[model samples]
Structures are given as C-alpha cells and as structure tokens.
Target chain A: MDVRFSPEQQALRDSAAQAVDRLGPHTVRDLEDTERAAKLDAAVEASGWRELRAAGEGRAPLASAVEAAIIAEEMGRGLADAPFVGATLAAELRRLVGAPPATARETVGFVADLSAPAVADRGTLPAGAVAIDARHSASALVLVPVEGGHAVAEVSLDASIPAEVDLTRPAATIAAGAGMERLGPVEQPLTADDLRRWTALGLGLTSADLVGVMRGVLSVACEYAGARRQYGVAIGSFQAVQHMLADACVAMEGSRSVALHAAWAVDALAAEEALAATAMAKAYCSRAARMVCETGIQVHGGIGNTWDCMAHVYLRRALLAIDVLGGAGANLQRVLDHNGIGGADGLR
Target chain B: MDFGDSPEEADFRRRLRDWLRDNNPGLPASSTSDAYWAGQAPWHQALYDAGFFGMSWPKDIGGQGLPSVYEVIVDAELARAGAPPRPSLGYLVVGIGHHASDDVKQRFLPGLVNGRDRWCQGFSEPDAGSDLASLRTRAELDGDEYVITGHKVWTSYSDAADWCLLLARTDPDVPKHRGLSAFAVPMRQPGIEQRPLKMINGVTREFGEVLFDGARVPAANMIGQPGEGWRLAMTVVSHEREPGELGYVARYSKVVSELGRQVKADPGKFGPEQVRDLGWAMIEAEMLRLHVSRRLSDRMDGISHGPEGSVDKLLMTAVEQAVGHAALSVGGTPHGDGDDMWLKVYLYSRAQSVMGGTSQIQRNLVASRILGLPAS
Candidate 1:
C-alpha cells in the first residue's frame, strides 16, 4: 500500500504549510473573541487552498479527500479557525450531491433558523423557498422545503453548515428560512453505501486533524524535554518523563498508519477493508490524540495548562475531534455492519 | 502493512486449532475446579510430541525452528480455544530454554516441553516489585556452586513448580540492575521453603512466597553469563507482557459466545445492558487481538519490544479490568454464582493488568520512551 500523496497533493500540502507558516508561532495563542475568527477567515482567502485543493484532478475521491485532509492538518497546526474544515465538507458534499447552483454558497452551522415567516422576511420568496442558514458566514441561504431535508439537495451550494457530531459533514445552523431557495423533495435517506462514504470522509478528516495535533504536541514536548533542565540534567534523561513522551510518539505513529491505510483503502475501493481501517483509525487516533495531548500537558507541568501555553490548544482540539462524528463505538458498529460479523446473522 | 495471516500461518493455525479441539478436554463448560489446569499437563505433552510446542526454538535445541510468529499464531489459537496456559513459564521465563546452556537445554527443555516439569518465576519481593532490579535476593558463589539465600514473594505456583527461575544478586556494590544472575533452582531441595499466599479470590492456586536459605545449585544452572541475569530477565519480562492474554482472549471469546447463546435462548432473564456489556467485551477482545497481532509481527521482524509493548500491556490490563467490571456488574456481586462464568472471568481478569507490569507503569514507559517527554 503505497499511500504517499501524488505530487500535486504533496504540493498542495506544502503550500498549505507555507501559508500556515506565514501566521507565525503564537498566532494560535493570539486568537481571541472575534479577532480569531476573522484571522482564520483571512488566512483561508490568502491560501487559495479551498479552490486549489478542490479542483485537483484525481480519479480517487478518497485520495482527493485526503488532499483536503492534508490541508486540514496544516490548518489545524496553525490553529487556523477559518471554516476550512466546513468548506472542505461543503466541496465534498457538492461533489457527492452534484454541483450546487451557480450562485449558491455553503457554510456549515448548527441551529438552523426554522421559525421565519415565509411572507415576512428577505425579498420575494420563490413559492416554497425556505431560507436556511447552514453557514453562519454565507451571504445567501439555501432554501429547500421543510419536507425536502438537507441530505439530497441538488444545485451545488456555495456554503453548507453541519450539525454537531454528524459523521457526514452537514452545515451549521443559520436564520430560519432566512436565505434558502426551494429544491426538490428529499430523494433518499443515507443508504449503507452512503453511510460508508460519509464515515470515510469524516473519519479521514478527523484522523488528519489528529495527526496534526499529535505532531504539534510531540514537537512541543520534545522541545520542552530538550530545553527544560532540572536537577543538573535535562529532564528528558529521566525515565519517568521519557516514557510519557515515548507513549505519545507511539500512539501518534499508530494513529497515522491506521489513518493512512484507511484512506488508502477507500481510494482503492476496498469497502470492507476501508470500514475496518477507518474504525481502527478513528478509534485509535482519538485515543492517541488524547494520550499525546495529556502527556504534552503533563510534560509541560503547570505551564501546560495555562492559557498562553500552546499545549492547551492542541488538547482542546483533540477533545473535540474525539467526540465529534459519533466516536469510535459508532464507527465500530459501522464496521461490524459492513463486514457482516459480530452481530446476529452477521448482518444488521 | 498486511494484517491477515499468511497462507502458511493460516494452515498452521487451522491444524493447531483442530488438534487442540481433539486433544484438549471439553470446553471449560463450568468453572469445574481445576478442570483448566487438569488438562494443561497432558495437553502440553501432546503438543510437545507433535512438535508444535516450541516453533520458535532451533531444531537442534528441540524446537521446530519456525519463525516465532508461528508460535504467536499457535498461542493465539490456544487462547481462543479456552485451553489452559500451558507454557506460561517455559515460553516466558525460559523462552524455550534459549538462555539455557547446552546441558541445561538437554536436561530441562525436554521435560518442560513434555509437561514433566512446571516452572515458576521468583522475581518480586516484599521490597521489590516495580523497581525489580533493587531485589535483595543474594547468591554467593562457593566454588562450583552458588549458595542462594533470599526471600521471594509473588512467586506464581511456586509450591507446585518443579523448579524456580530465581534471580539473585551475585554482587553487592554494582548498579542495582546489574550484578544479578538467573538460576534454575530445584524446588524439592532442602533449604527451600514455600508458604502459600491467599489471593483476593480466596483460592491459593499454589501462589506462594518462597524462602531460599542457603539453597545450593551448580553454577551450571545459570542461564547465561553470571552477570547476564538482568538482560535475560528483561527479555522474559517483555515476552510475558507482549503476548498479553492472546490465547485467553480467544478461549474466553468462545466461552462468552456459548454463554451468549444460552442467554439468547433465555432472553427473558438477561437485559439489554447485560447483552451490550457482553458485546463490548467481545469487541474489546478483538481490539486486544489486533494490537497483539501487530506487535507479534513487529517482534518477528526483529523489532525491539519497545514502548509499544507497554501500549499493549496497558490496553490488555484495561480491557481485563473493564471485562471484569462488566462481569461483576452483570453478575450483581463479587464471585457471584461460585461457578458462574462471569465471576471466574472477572476474578481472573484482575490479574491481567497487574501482572507483567502495572498499567500505570506501562503508561509511564510510553510517556518517556515513546513520546520523548519530560518526566514529572
């Protein structure tokens, strides 16, 4: 399984990293209130990553998805708060559900506004148009029927908001019926195949985030161990400290391999293999991210928990990612269902 | 990169599983007193006769000389079968007698493989557990023999062991980890005392603290060079910790599967939580199996048993604790249904995370060695 990215993908990742580097260290520490959100948005525009990554030519949607994953990792490393993740999810959804309307824009959000009076707000409403704010940042609302639901909309959107912990990236909530146009009726619920695709996409992205967090945390830890001296010796020499750091490294590596293999399997169209791989990756990466972040904090001691410390940012991100997407158990159930094992009749 | 067993491995596993089914006693259907151990000796001998006992050992040394991965596959099958752990001491402490001298190999390995002898490790002491090298057990060399005198605690099955693999300090003032030697001491000899220690389960299972007062053994009994005991002990410890109940996981899976069938047949009695817990235990077992399999592949590829082994150890112990907790929760009491499958499993699972090395210690190893973090 040669899981290395294509040259184009690698170039994209490298570009993202360079763009992230422009933000400088301690930028993440500086993000506070509205300024942080604005900086993240600015960085996204500057990178052109959204357009470049989405447009890359690759037969494998999974591999193309991984290109976005790479971008996510870099964004995470920079602690860029822009909705790159949300944007990437939008792009993938567009690809999956067919191109959005030429004028459509997507932003992922929770708490979609559902109480808007059809006749009261926002210009002439097209017959049954319901203004739905999926992206808090979107200029326009995606209007679909109350009965249509969001999963099967056509005419690609510019922005789409996602709900909390939804494995398949959905958009965030916006003003109810504030800005959407009418689409056709809901065509389908997520089929098993659809769930499989959704799981890979979510898991792949989260796994990438985990790898980035781990890398960032480990780098800080190693730097701390090397620089921080006590008792006339670098604390790194002490067995107690060394073991903690070592565990984080090991977990990080395990998570990376699992994630890569899962992504690779998806690209290869090995569905059963991808299911198992993604489950193992998500489960292990979540655990690893937690382990590494905690160890990072422990290694840094009192300072690690402070607001100014970089470790705390990674720790929070790790916690959020681990809980996002319904967690390891949900993924395992997916795997169990896909593989037809471990359940009655081996089919759920 | 490949997780599936190779064709050869698959065939070997199938043969071993089939052989075990035919030769091993009936499914440990009940918590039949000693039914597990009762079948161990004969089964070990049968495996030895079939040349399947020590695939990792060199043929000249009475092993089949196959890659050690085969041993892992074999043990994995045996574990899945619910067969007793037959070579715990031999494969672990003795490592198929790899450290044993030619004479030692000739004398002890055949009997060990054939189940004519049982071996127990004597490492932990009242004062030394995690800081194992600080053990106070001393062995003073006297001409062709070494006079051993020290007290060893937490010696598993010492009372029943034909011989004890004891580590003793041969030098007084060197570093703590160094200056130690491993000896194969006969348990039946004079100057040896064994006092059974009751465990939390209330059954001794031959657990004991052994006292060696001037126990003499020829220097020939030493596994390797005089000061090589530390290395040997570490090797044995890694092996013991690395496998982490692969076979027991397999066997228990079967038992649990059977139990699930019975529960399903009488669903009126078991609730969703009980069923869910059982399902979780099964999933936990699979996770443990995958981790161990990866480690086994790494080991066979000559990768050092590094901090990753500690991860396995931690997971194993945690799963064991979780399984035990689930069993106890389901059974509604400690040691419920004296012969209840849940209770026995729960009781035994407690030992998994504690032995080899405590889960906390393994975590420490991971933090320092794998993550390269600063110690607190």
Candidate 2:
C-alpha cells in the first residue's frame, strides 16, 4: 500500500503550514495579542478546514481524515493557537449522525478527566466537563442517548472559563447543568460503529498533533544546539547534546510514521481495524512527544525552563494533545482490551 | 495513502496462507540443536519452491520481479501462522546483487535465491567488530588466486554455508577503508576452519567463528573492484540493520502476540505493572510495523532512504528490547514449559542493540551524518 501523500495532499500540507506560519504565535508573548488570535480564528473559519468532514451532496466527508490530520499537525507545529481538533471532531460527529453541519464554528465537550465525551442529559450539560479548542466557537458538541443509539447535541461553550496549561488552544470546563439542545431531524442515529470511527479520528488527529509538536520542538532544540556555545564550541558539537537531539529525531520520526498510518486507517480500514491503528498511534505519539519535548527543554539547558523559551509552548501543546483523546497509558489499555489480552480466549 | 493490499497482493497472500495452513512445519522453539537448524533449511526451500521468496529480486535471478510489498506480506503471514522465519540473508543478496560481476551474478544468484547455495558473511572480526575498517583480514594476490587469511567472529551459518562473502585487506599501504576488498570464497576450501559458538540462549548454529590460514578464491571471484570493499561493506551493513531486510517487525509481532496469549490464559499470573509493560511492548511492535510499512511504501514510490535507515535501526532496537523485557516480566520465574524462550528472547534482545551496529554507533551515525552535528 502506498503511504506517500499524493501531490494534492502535499499541497494541502504546504498551504496549512503557510497559514500557521503566517498567523501563529512567534513567541509566548504573542499569545496575548487578542487581535491576532481573532484574525487567526477568522482565517481558520474562512479556510473551510473546520468543515473538512461536513457531508457533501453524496453524503460523504468533503475531505479524507488524512487531510484534516495534516491541518492539525501543521497547526500544532506552528503553535497556531486556534480550534481545529475540536471543530473537526464536532464536524465528524455531525456527519456520522446525519445532522446538519454547524452554522458557526463548533468544538466538542470532553468529560473532566478527558477520558471520553461528556454525555448531556435532557437539555443540560454536566459540570466539570471540558470543552477543548473552543476559544472562538459558539458551541461544543455533546452526546444525547436516544432510542437504540446516541443523538447529536450541542451545549454553549463559556469562553470566560479559567485559563488552562495550554496557552495556544483553550480548554474550558462548563458549569453544572448548562443548557443544551439536540440537533434535530436526525436522518441517522449514532451507533457504536459511528462512535468508534469518530474516536479513531480523534485519536489519529491528536497523534498527528503530537508528531508535529515533537518535530517543531526538536527543530528549535537543534537550532539552539548549533548556536549556543560552551567551551569555545557549539554545544551541538558535544556528542551528549547531539545524541539527545538525534534520539528525539528518531522518536519524532517513529511517531510521525505511525501517526500517518493511523490517519490513513481512519478512512481506509474497517472501523475496528482503524480504531486499533489509532490506539497504537496514540500510545506511541503520546510517549514519544513527551520525551521529545523534554529533550528540547534539556537541550536548551537554562533558557528552556523560562517562560520566554518556545520549547515549553510545544511541551504544553503536546501534553494537552496527548491527553485529549487518550494518552500513552489509556491508549495502551484500549489496545490491550481490544486484543483481549487478559481474556479467557485470546490470540485466536 | 492506503494501507490495504492490492488485488494481486491479496490473492497472493491468500494463497500463501493456504499453503502455510496445509504445510506448516511447526518446528521446536528456539534451540541450539542441529535438528532445529536443519528444519529451517527445508522450510526455506519449501517457501522458495512455492514462489514466496525472491519476490523483490530481479527476474533473471529467479525472482518474480514484483515489488517488495509481496515479500512483506509473506513475512507477516508467516509470523501470523507461527511458521518458520524466511531465511534472512538479504545482506548477501544485496551485496552480490549490487556489486558482483555479470558472470558472478548469473552463476550464484539463482542458487542463492532458492537456498541451494547457503551463504554466511565474514565481515566482523574480534578486533574489528564495530570498527570494521580496522580488520586485519588479508587477501594476498598469489597467481590467479587470492589467499585469504583472517579470523571472523559472530559469523552466521558458519558451519553449514557453502560460500562466504568475506572482506579482506588487499592493499596494506592505502587508507584502512580503501585498502580492503570483498571476496566470494568457497567455505570448504583448504586452510578454512569453523568453530561454533554458543549464544547466551544456547543457540550454537546461529553463530560461530571462522579462522583462515589461507582460504583461496579465484581472483575473478572478487565481488567488485579491489579497494571498494568498504563501500560494499557499508551497503551490506546498512541492509543488515534494516527491519524489512530481516523481516523483524513480523517476529516482534509474533512475540507480542504470544505474550498476550500467555496473559490471557492466566491473567492473574501478572501484576498490573507487568501487564502495562506488555501493553507498551505491543504498542512498540505496532509502531515498528507501521514504520516499516511507511518505509516499504516509500520504496514503492521510488523514494530511497539513505541514513534515515539509522532511525529505523534505533527504533528496531528499542522495540526488540522492550518486547524482550516485557516477555520476561510477564513470564514470572521462567520455570514453565516455554518460559526459557522468554529468557532466550530477553538475552537475544540485548544483541539487537549491539549487533549490526551498536545502538551507540547508530546514534552516532544519525547525529553526524543525518542531523549534521559537528564531530567532537
């Protein structure tokens, strides 16, 4: 099977990179530029990237999962501080349940611990439910249990919630019993398979983000290694620093390869198979991203620890992405359970 | 990008699975016994006879001239069915295929493809394990023959190989890397000696040492021009470390699967930490599978990976060692019927980082060559 992107896909990736580079933060202080953030949010909406999964006339996704993941990764690499994952996942949910796409930007609400989606009750959202990547979004998507399956629901996203660890994208927990509304005239109810496919996309997108974060941070670290000198030579000249950066590069490459496969699987393989692939990618990317980000900080030595350095921004973004769908530990368990690892009958 | 098989690949894979289901010779677990080694020879021949081997080699060399993905399918299916491993002599195939003369290729490749000409490599010496350019293996020109004299350690298939693709110093005055040349020496010739060496896991036939007072080969048997041995060695060495060349991902998958089976059969036998370790190892194995798939895909897309193969090598070592440790941790006490296999795996996994090139060497190559870090 071919894993290399087609020319169109490459063009999409390049375009996404250019957009992020043009509008994303250049320094931690840039996060305070509310006008720039609004511009980026508007630019992202205008790009129609948030609706990549919106149903076309044929009732299929406008673009494949790989394209959406490419946007997520580029956003992550440039620390684009905009709502992509949540918006894209919200669109995927709507497509799966045959609901009309959101008129405005939409994000998703995850339970407080961020293990799974928050299930909304009759016209109400739960307390301590986190809405991810919802800075400029009007509403966050939730699940409403209906006859035989779940129906698509939306709850208002409170943009005024307290700030979180990730300075780029905003993750806010809603108040208890917040008002909600279910999307209507449902052509199809969301089944277990539908949810599985959505979760696979979520996992794949987050994994791609982690790959981007690792690559971005490693690039910063390598540049620093070449410029920062100690003992009359660049610190990169030392095998210790070079080896550390090299290890980070390897981990990032490994994370990238698996993440790409996971993204491809979301559209190409069966739901169960795709879920397995995404779970593996999530585990690998989560672990490697954390290590690579730490290596980035380590390579910078003292400055890496300060708020001024960009390495921490990558680390912060990576932590949120790693834990968004499932982190190393959670995804590992999902894979094990999927494989029936501790079952009475296994390996058949 | 797609990960699914084409129709032809799917059909071939299905037939290969059917063949394996009917004819799988499930040999004994890893052992030092000649019986274990003997079993592999027939298995290799059976696979080649069924046209499952040499799928990526040129057609003139008895291959199907198909892309490498077909071979990957064979590898994965073989591991899935618990069948014997395909003979992992891709380094030799690459060395001879890329460098040997036309006559040499026509003479040796066909036999090599179907397992008629069993071969081993004589590259590593006791003093030249990682610093291979420093090898003192001498091949002096004597009439129309080169008399080779050297000692090689950790030589695979030493006891049974009919031919040995070896490296020796041909010009002592030149630079170490340039003075060396490659030779295809007959293993049964006079002044050649083989001594089997037992591994930590008790596998003897898999490794051995070779001593040569003067193993003679015709001057025409040199694989390439004299003093090009280092380049050829680099090619073979890089191929040796590649995961696809040895079908290592499939083996890792099998290891992870068996471990999962063990935990399932007796869930209470493992603690939470041990189970976590097993899960992590499974993820690592899956990562390598995905990584190798991408590499194969790149190959299919006419993309050649150079020093980036080092990245795969480091990842391979990590996966191997992680699986080994996980298997040992899960298989408590190592006293059950197949527990020794876990111990063997753990021991052998240590060699993955050390063999081909030490993980340290791999990191060095990646740092200096790929990352462009200054040498210090």
Candidate 3:
C-alpha cells in the first residue's frame, strides 16, 4: 500500500509551512508580541483551517483528519502561540451532534485533570473545570446527559488566566455550577460511538503535534551542536553529542510514522479501530517527546534553562500537547482497556 | 496514502494462507535439537516448491517474477501460521544478483533461490566483526583461479551451506576498502573447514566458524571490480537490516499477540504492572509495523534502501527486547515452559542486538552516514 502523501496533501503542507514561516514566532520575545499574535490569529482564522471538520454534504467532514493534523503539526513546529487546537476541537464537537456552528469563537471545556471533555448534568458544570487554549474564545462546549446518550452545550467565557506550566496557550476556569445552555436539537443525539470517534480525532492531532515537537527540538539541537565548538571542534563532532541527536532522530521518525498511520485510520477504519490506533500513536509519541526534548536542552548546555533559548519553548508546547487527550501513561491505559485487560468483560 | 493490500495481493495472501494450513510440518519445539535443525531444510524446500520463496526475483532466476510485496505477504503469513520465520537469505540474493556478472547469476541464482544450493555469508572474520573494512582475508589470483586463505566466524548455516558468498582482499597494496573482492566459493571443496558453534540458546548447525587454506575459486566468480567489495557487502547487509525487506514487524506482531493471549489466559498470574508492560510491548510492536509500512511505501515509490536501515535495525532491537522482557516477567520462569516458549524468546532476543550488526555499529553508521557527524 502507498503511504506517500497525494499531491493535494503535499500542496496543503507546503502552504501550511509557508504560513507558519511568515507568521510564526522567530524569537522568545516574539511570544510577547501581541501585534504578531493577533496577526497570527487572523491569518489562521482567514485560512478556515479550524473549520476543516465542520459538517459538509451528507453530514461528512469538509476535509479528512489527515488534513487537520497537517495543520496542527505545522503550528506545533513553529511554536505558533495561536488558538488552533481549541477552536478546531470546538468545531469537531459541533459537527458530531449536527449542531450549527456558534456565531462567536469557541473551544471545548475539560475536566478530570484537564484531559477529557467536561461533562455537565442538567446544564451545570462541576467545579475545577477549565477550557484549554481558550485565548480568543467567547464560549466553550460541554457534554450534557441526553435521552440516548449525550448532547453538546456551550457556556460563555469571561477571560483566560495565564497557564502556569505551558506558556504557549491560555486556560480559563469555569466556576462550579456554571450554567451551560444546550445547542439547538437535531434528529440525532451523540452516542458512545460518536464520542469515541471524537476522542480518536483529538488523540491523533495531539500525537501529530508531539511528532512536530520532536522534529523542531531535534533541529534546534542539531544546529547548536554544529555551531557550538569547544577545543577547536564542533560539539557535533563529538560522538557523545552525535549519538544523542541520532537517537532522538530515530525516535522522532518512529513517532511521525505511527502518528501518520493513526491520522489515516480516522477515516479508513471503524470508530473503535480508529480509537485504538490513535491511543497507541499517542502512547508512542508521548513517551518519546520528553526524552527527545531533554536531548535538545542538554545539547544547548547551560543556555537551555534560561528563557532566551527556544528549546524551552519547544518543551513547554510539548508538555501541553502530551497532556491533551492523554499522556503516555493515560494512553497506555487506554490501550489496555481497548485490549480488554482488567476490563469487566475480560478478554475479547 | 493507503496501507491495505491490493486485490491481486489479497488473492496471493489467501493462497499462501491456505497452503500453509494444508502443508503444516510438525517439527520439534526445541530449536537446539537435531530434529529441529533437520526439519528446517525440508521446510525451506517446501516453501520454494510452493512458490512462496523468492517471489521477488526475476523469472530467469526461477522465481515468480513478482514484486517484493508478495515476499512480504509470505513472511507475514508464515509468522501468523506459527511456522518458522522466513529464511533471511535475501542478503545472499542481493550480493550475487546486483554485483555478479550475468554468467555468475545464471550459474548460482537458479539453484540458490530454489533451495537447491544453500549459501551462507563469509564476511565477518575474528577481527573484522563490526569493522568489516579491517578484514584480513586474502585471495591471490592464479592463471584461472583465485587461491583464498582466511578465517571467517559467525557464518550462519555454514554447515548446511553448499557455497559461501565470501569476501577476501585481492589487492593488499590498495586501501582496505578498495583492495577487496567477493567470491562464491564452493563450501565443500578442499582446504576448507567448517566448525559449527553452539549458541547460548543451545542452537547448533545455525552458525559456524570457517577456516580456509588455499581454497581455490574460479576467477569468473569475482563480483564486480576489485574495489567494489565494500559496496557489495553494504548492499547485502542492508537487505536484511531493513524491517520492510525482512518483514520483521509481522514477526514481532505475532510474538506480541501470543504474549497477550498468555496474559489473558491467566490474568491473576501477572501483576497489573506486568499487564501494562505487555501493553507497552504491544504498542512498540505496532510502532515498528507502522514504521515498516511507511518504509515499504517509500520503497514502492522508488526510494532506494540505504543508511536509513540502521534506524530500522535499532527500532527492531528495542521492540524485540521490550517483547522479550514482557515475556520473561509475565509468563516465563527461570526454565522456559515448553508450550509457551517465553524464556527461549528472551534468550534469542539478546542475540539480535549483536548479530548481523551490533547496535553500536548501527548507531555509528547512522551518525556518520545519515546525520553527517564526524567519525573518530
């Protein structure tokens, strides 16, 4: 079977790369440039990439999950401090239950350690709920108990507090018992199958972003190795440095390959199969990203700990990406559940 | 991009599955046993007879003249059916077909591919294991033949081999990398000695050390130019090193699933941590499968195999060890269970990191050749 990207996918990737290069942050200071951040947000909005999963003919997605993942990866590579992942997940939720798109910007709310979608009972959210990457959003979607299963609802966003660990994105908390209004009803309610498919999409995107993080950090480390010389030789000439970079490169490629396969499986396989693939991809990427990112920092020597170097930027973005949907441990647990280990029904 | 078999490929796969089921050979479980080693040749011949072996070679070489994907299907199905792993003689095929003259191919390939003439590699000597360029095997040209004198170790299947696709230094004055030549020497000829070594797993007849004293070879057997030996050896090594070429993903997948079955059979026997370790092993296996699928896709798109195979080798070692460790902690005892064979797998897994090429050498190759890092 052919795994090479089609010409159209290649064209999309090229355009995404071009956009990131133009509007992406170049220095650590660029993260503080509100003017550049606004422009980046506008460019992403104008591109309509966030709505790629919006309903189309026959209630299908406008584009494939692979296309959405391509955009996410490019955003991650540039460390573009924009509102893509949140806005995109918000669109995915609307499309899942056949709800019309909200007039204002929106993202999905998360509960339970900020890993899964927040669930509301009778249009009321529990305390400690937060909306991730809700920088410019006006509302956030939360799931509500329905007749057959669940339905989508939205609660207004006041403002985002600065996220502590991950500097790239902003997170906002919803007060306990915050009111959420149900979206206008359609013929179908969301089922467990629907949520599983949505989780697959979320996991696939995060895995892609983690792959991008590895790629970006490894590039930074390699350049540093080639330039930073000691005792009249580039550090890259040292076997110790070369081997570290090489190991990172290998792990990064493995993550990319598995992530691509998971993205493809979203449209090609059944919902359960897609979820399993995404969980495995997420596990692989999550485990590799931290070690690979550390290798980048290690190669940079002392400057890596300071705010000036870009290695911290990559690592920060990666930690957030790793936590989205699930980290390495959570994803491995998902795999175990899917395989029926420790499950009530026992083996398949 | 798609990763499923085409209609024709699906059909070939179905046929092979049926064949394996109908012609299953019940061999002894212990690979160290004489009965098991005796069973290997017959299995190889049966696969050849059924057109499941060498499906990728040209028609003139007694192959089906199919794409390499067919061979991949055969490998996967063999693993799925609990048969022996696919024979790894693609190296020998690559060494002879790519560098040898037409007459050489016509003389050796037909028999080699069909299991009529078994061959082993005589490349790694005592001092040349990882640093193959430093080999001291010598071959001096006479009127119509070359007289070879050298010692080669770690030659797999040398005892059963009808010929040894040997590498020797034909010009000592030139640089080591430039002075070498390859020969398809007769294994049973005079001045040749084969001493099969017992591996740590207690497997005999699978590997050997050979000594040569003026072993004569026809001058026509010299493959390519005098200095092309290094290139040919690299080519040969890459064939087996690639996960795509060897279908290593399918082999690992089979083992991982088997381990899963064992854990499921008696979940109480394993701790939660052990089960999670099994899950980790499962994902690692899947990672290799995905990586190999992408590499195969690249190969189908006409990208040639090269130094990147070192990446595949490294990943394979990691995955295999992960699976082996899972097997040991979850199901294996100090002594292996006959039905499960967990400890046997664990022991063999350690050998993989060192065989064919050591993991250190693979990283060195990747660093220097792929990453443009300076070599010491």
Q: Pick the candidate with the highest TM-score.
A: 2
Runs off by more than 4 Å, candidate 1: A1-191, A197-201, A211-215, A218-307, A328-348, B27-33, B48-57, B62-86, B89-117, B173-176, B244-280, B334-340, B373-376
Query: What digit string (tens of lDDT, one per residue) describes model 2 on residues A1-348?
Result: 667899999999998898888898988899999888888878887888988988887778999999999998999898988889988999899888888878887789988767788887665556678888877777888998888789988877666465566888877666456667888767988998888899999999999998888878987888888889999999998988888988999999999988999999998888988898899999899999999999999999999999999999999899889888779877887888888774433221
Q: Which candidate order results from sorting by DockQ in descending order?
A: 2, 3, 1
Per-prediction share of native contacts kept: 0.17, 0.77, 0.60
Q: Candidate 2: DockQ?
A: 0.62
Q: Best by DockQ, which number? A: 2
* Candidate 3 lDDT, B53-147, residue by residue in tens: 87777889987887665665776687678676566677788778889889889999889888888888999999998889999999998999999
Candidate 3 i-RMS: 2.6
lDDT agreement with native, every candidate: 0.61, 0.85, 0.83
- When summed lDDT is taken over every stretch of 10 residues in candidate 3 chain A, the lowest stretch is A339-348
Query: Which predicted model would earn the best lDDT?
Result: 2
| Residue B278 Cα positional deviation in candidate 2, in Å, after optimal superposition | 1.7
TM-scores of the candidates are: 0.71, 0.96, 0.95
Shift of residue A58 alpha carbon in model 3, Å: 0.6
Better of 1 and 2 by lDDT: 2
Report model 1's TM-score to 2 decimal places.
Answer: 0.71
Tens digit of per-residue lDDT, candidate 3, span A62-126: 99999999988888887878888888888888888999876898898988477788898655676
